[model samples]
Target: MKLAIVVGHNARSQGAVRPDTGETEFAWNSRLAKMIEEEARLFPRIRVKTFFREYCGSYRREIAEVYDQVDAWGADASNELHFNSHSSRTATGTEVLSSGSDASLRYARALQERMGAALGLKDRGVKVRRSGRGSESLMSGRAPAVLIEPFFGSSPEGQAATDEEHEQRALARSILQATQDAFL
Candidate 1:
């Protein structure tokens, strides 16, 4: 099976926070997204690719590139990386969003459960993002694509944990496990 892993946004973007400092969300998200794709390379039958917009481009540019790659290789699934942020320090959980397919929902659920289990966090549950705010994901043309938010920054729960590498690893492992459970 073919897979595309997309890092949500540029780590250096304005409002981005460093996980180690309890500020930046992309610090953990981007690294973990890369880790997931790298680990997927271990499976012989899975052809994995990664997409990101960190350097000299925009999300539009990066996703366009992803679309080209997906078209070229006929990717079967896509994973978009993101982190949850909230005003209250009480919110702490993981969630996944799909375009609207049973397979997509199942994949999201497995991802939510696995990541929640790995991080000992609350399972925020999976849902279809059909409204306006998530339009980027809805129109990405990457069918069966899901966006995962595993941690909530600015939350008291988020400030409690500081091991960026360990957090990233846990999330990446869940991503790999989800892919294996579904595609492999």
Candidate 2:
């Protein structure tokens, strides 16, 4: 199977910030992307392609760039990695946003449930995002696609998790397991 991993934001337009560690969501997700690709590559018959904005152009510049890459890379499924943020520091959990397609919905649920469990986070449930967060996911892939927010970056728990040794590896494993369950 072919998979495309998208790191959520560019350097200039970084996403959420972890309160305790002062870590940017973009930096965390870039690390997760690298770890995910490294681990996923060990699986048999799996081909991986990536859209790391740090290495390429920003998705916000032209959302169509991600859509174009879906066809260009011929991915079987794709995932966009992100960390959510909110005004409330106490708010913490996991969310999976789909394109409202049945396929994507299924994929989103698998990912959301697994990551929420793995991270010991509250399950925020899977929902349709017509625009904004998961829009590029919908426009891009021919197969199932999802945007995963595994934790609240602004929350203390979220910040603490990122500080753990090999937190990126653990999250990457969560992503890979979910992807295998959904697409493999």
Candidate 3:
């Protein structure tokens, strides 16, 4: 199976109300992409591809290219990665979303479980998403795609705890483990 990973916005993209200081969406994306790539090296059956490593303009345009690139590469599955945030400080934990298709839902549930186990975070459970401004069209086609907000990265506790290298690696490991369990 081939997998395509998409990092969030540009390093300078307009962030939400609460953004991570000194950490751009691009930076977080690059880190997550690298982590996933490293783990893919361990699994021989699956190949991984990264979409939109660099940012120009027009997020919609870039996302379209990502979809085309993955489609042309014949990826069996595509995952769009991003961190979550809320206006309220109380919100926490990880979330996985599927297209409500059996396969996608299965992947979402398994991934959510693995991530929760590895991260020791609360389970926000899996949900099906339909429409959105930022949704990827790559998923709109033949490939199975889902958007993952692994944690509320902007949360006060999350930001404080996740700034360290060890914590980041741990989070990455959880994501990688979830990928292995879900796909392999």
Question: Against the true structure, whose TM-score is highest?
Answer: 2
Candidate 2 segments whose C-alpha is farther than 4 A from its true place:
54-61
What is candidate 1's CA lDDT for residue 12?
Answer: 57
User: Candidate 3 residues 82-148, lDDT tens each?
Assistant: 7778778778888888887777776778778876776666788887877674455425546877777
Model 2 per-residue lDDT at 83: 88
Looking at model 1, which ten-residue stretch has the lowest summed lDDT?
14-23
After superposing candidate 3 on the true structure, give the runs of residues whose Cα lies further than 4 Å from its correct spot: 11-20, 53-59
Poorest stretch of ten by lDDT in candidate 2: 54-63
Candidates ranked, most accurate by lDDT first: 2, 3, 1
**Candidate 2, residues 45-127: lDDT per residue as tens digits?**
66777785543555554446765676688888888888889998889888888988877887888898778767888888998
Q: What's model 2's lDDT at 100? A: 84
Q: Is candidate 1 or candidate 2 better by lDDT?
A: 2
Q: What is the lDDT of residue 147 in candidate 2?
A: 87
**Residue 49 error, candidate 3, Å:** 1.5
